[model samples]
Target: MPSLEVIDEHIVLDILSSTVRLVGSLLPNNIEVVLHDLRNPECSVVEISSPSITGRKKGDSVISGARRDPAFANLMEFSSEPITYVLNYETQDNAGNPLRSSSAIYRNAQGMPFAALCINADYQQIDKAIALIQQLTASELNPTFKKEQQVIISEPTPDNIDALLQEIIDIAMEQNPGSNRPAIKKANLVAVQRMQERGIFIIKGGVEKAAKALGVSRYTVYNYLDELKAQNEGE
Candidate 1:
C-alpha cells in the first residue's frame, strides 16, 4: 500500500477548485465560494461558486470582499501556523446587502501564502423572513417578541492597495490626534503602533507610506516598531 504523499501546489489548487464547486452546490444558494491565487493579485480568483451572492467570477482580484479586511489580511502575521483563517466577519455585497464572510489562507512548503479560500453568505432574505414571522406571531401586549434588528457592516473594500494603506493611516491618525510638538511625537508613536498591530507594515512599501502619512522618516518608523517590541516584551 502507498502512503499519502505531499502533492504539488497546482494539484492542491485543482483539488480545492473541485471542492469549491462541490461545497457551493451542497450549500444554500445564497452562499458563495471562491478560490484565489495569491501570487497573482491582479487576477487572483481562479475558481468561483454560487457567483450570484457576490457577483465574483474567475480572473477577479482578491482586493475586494474579505481580502481587504484588516483582520483577515493580518491573520498570518499573528499566527505561527502555516495555515491561518478568519471567520464570521460582517461584510456587504455590491448592492449593499449584508453578508457573513470568512476566509482561509493556504501556504506552500516555504510558508508563503499561495492561495486563499473565501466564503460569503448573504442572509438578508432570511432576516426578512424571520422578521415577518415574528410580526405575525407576536402578541399585541407582549413587547418582548418585537426585537430590534441589529446588523454590523464592515467597511467597504478600497479600490487599490494604495487606497487601503491611506485608509489605515487616516484611521490611525484619527485615533491618535496631537497639536503640540511633544504631543505630536507621542501621537506618531501611537499611530505607528496601531498600524503595526493592524499589519500595515507587512506589505511592500507599507513603511514608506506610513512614514509619509505620519510626517516622519522611514527610519523613525523602524525605531517606533523596535520600541513597541521592547514595550511588549517588558509587559
Candidate 2:
C-alpha cells in the first residue's frame, strides 16, 4: 500500500502533484489525472492533466460533486472503514462522455483526508471500436452489454460560497435527529454536530454559517463545538 501519512495539507499537495506529472506522462491521451485539495472544496483542483477530458482546470470548485459523492463524504466524516481508495467507479464529463474513474485518498497523521488523486479515463471511443469490430466479424451482439452508469458531472463552481454553506446547513438540520425536536438547544447542538461530522467547520466562514442557521451567535457555535469536543474526548 502507498504511504498516506503527510505532515500537513501542503505536503499532501506536493506529493499528489508529483504523482500527477509522472502518471500523466505515461497515461494515454484519453486518461486524465486530477488532484484535489479536500480541505478547500471550493477551488479544490490544484493540478490537473489532460484537463480537456472534463473541462476542469486548476482552481475549479467541486463542492457540488463532493456533497453528492459518497466516497468524498465518507472521507470527510472519517468513516471507520479501511478504505484508502475508490476504484472502477463511473461518472460522466461536462460533454457527457463516459468516464471510468478511480480516486486515491491521501490522509494526514490523524487519518483525515486532505487530498485526492483521481484518474478519469474516457472510454467512449473504445466502446465504439468494440462494437465496430463485433459487427465486422458478423458476431452476434452481446445481450448483456453494460449500460452507462449515468453519473452527471455538473458545473464545478457554485454562484458563491455562501450558497454552498447554506445548502450544507439545511441538509444537516434536516437529517440530524434532535434537530427536528422542540428543544432549541438540542436542535442547535445536533445541527452543529452534524456540520462538524461533515467537516463544514474546516472551511472559512463555516462557523458563522452554522451560527446563522441555528439562530445563535458565532460564539455560541464555538461553545457547541467545544462541548462536542469534550464529548468526544470523554468517549
Candidate 3:
C-alpha cells in the first residue's frame, strides 16, 4: 500500500480542484479562489481564478506577503496546532483596495502541510454600504477593521505512529496544564480517549504505539479506552 502521505496528497488535490470550481460558481466574479502547492514555492499557485482582481495567476510564485506568515513553519515544526479557519478577516491588495478573505490549509499523512485554498473577495462596495448604514443608524457598533491574513486549516494526519502518539499525549496533558501524576494519568486517559475518537487505533500497531508513548502497558491503554467507553455510555 502507498504511504498515507501519497494518498493524502492526492485527496487534497482532488478536493481543492473540485471545491474551487464549486465556490467560484456559487459566488460572484468578485470572489477569487487560489490554490497553492507549498512544496513548489517558486510557482506556488497551481490553480487560481479571477486573476485580474487578485493579480495572481496559475504558476505564480508564492507572494511576498504569504512567505512571511508564521503558520507556514507549522508544516515542519508540528509543535503548534494550526487553526482550521478564521472568518471575517480583512486584508488588501497591493493597490490598497480592501479585501475580505478566508483560507483552508491541507496536510499530508506525514503531518507535512502541503497546500492552501484561499478566497479573497473585494469589499469596497460592502464597506461603503456599511458606512452609509452606520451613519443612518448612529449605532454604537464599531465597523472598524484591520488588515490580516487568513488562518491555516488542516486535520491532524498522523504520519509516524510515535510522533502521532506523542502529539496526542501532549494535547491531552496540555488540556489541564500540569505535570503531577494524577494530572498526567487523567491526561493519559484523555489522550487515550481522544485517540479512540480520532480512529488512531485503526492503524496497524497503533495500540502498541499508544502504550509506548503513554508509558503504560498495552493493557492499560485498553483499560483507559474501556473506561472512556463506559463514561460515554453513562452520559
Q: How high is each candidate's TM-score?
A: 0.57, 0.53, 0.45
Give a tens-digit lDDT track for model 2, residues 149-205: 455555443444566556655655565545335555665777677566444675556
List candidate 3 segments past 4 Å from native.
Answer: 1-6, 64-83, 125-235
Error of 2 at 208 (Å): 8.6
Ranking by TM-score: 1, 2, 3
Ranking by lDDT: 1, 2, 3
Top model by TM-score, which number? 1
Q: How much is the lDDT of residue 179 in candidate 1?
A: 75
Each model's number of backbone clashes? 0, 0, 0
Against the true structure, what is every candidate's RMSD?
Answer: 6.1, 8.9, 13.5
Best by lDDT: 1
Residue 92 error, candidate 2, Å = 2.8
lDDT of 3 by residue, 4-63 (tens): 444557667777878777777777767778887767654567777776556666676544
Q: What TM-score number comes out for model 1?
A: 0.57
Model 3 Cα shift for residue 141 (angstroms) = 33
TM-score of 2: 0.53
- Which regions in candidate 1 have their CA more than 4 angstroms from the true location? 1-8, 41-43, 50-104, 119-128, 139-154, 171-235
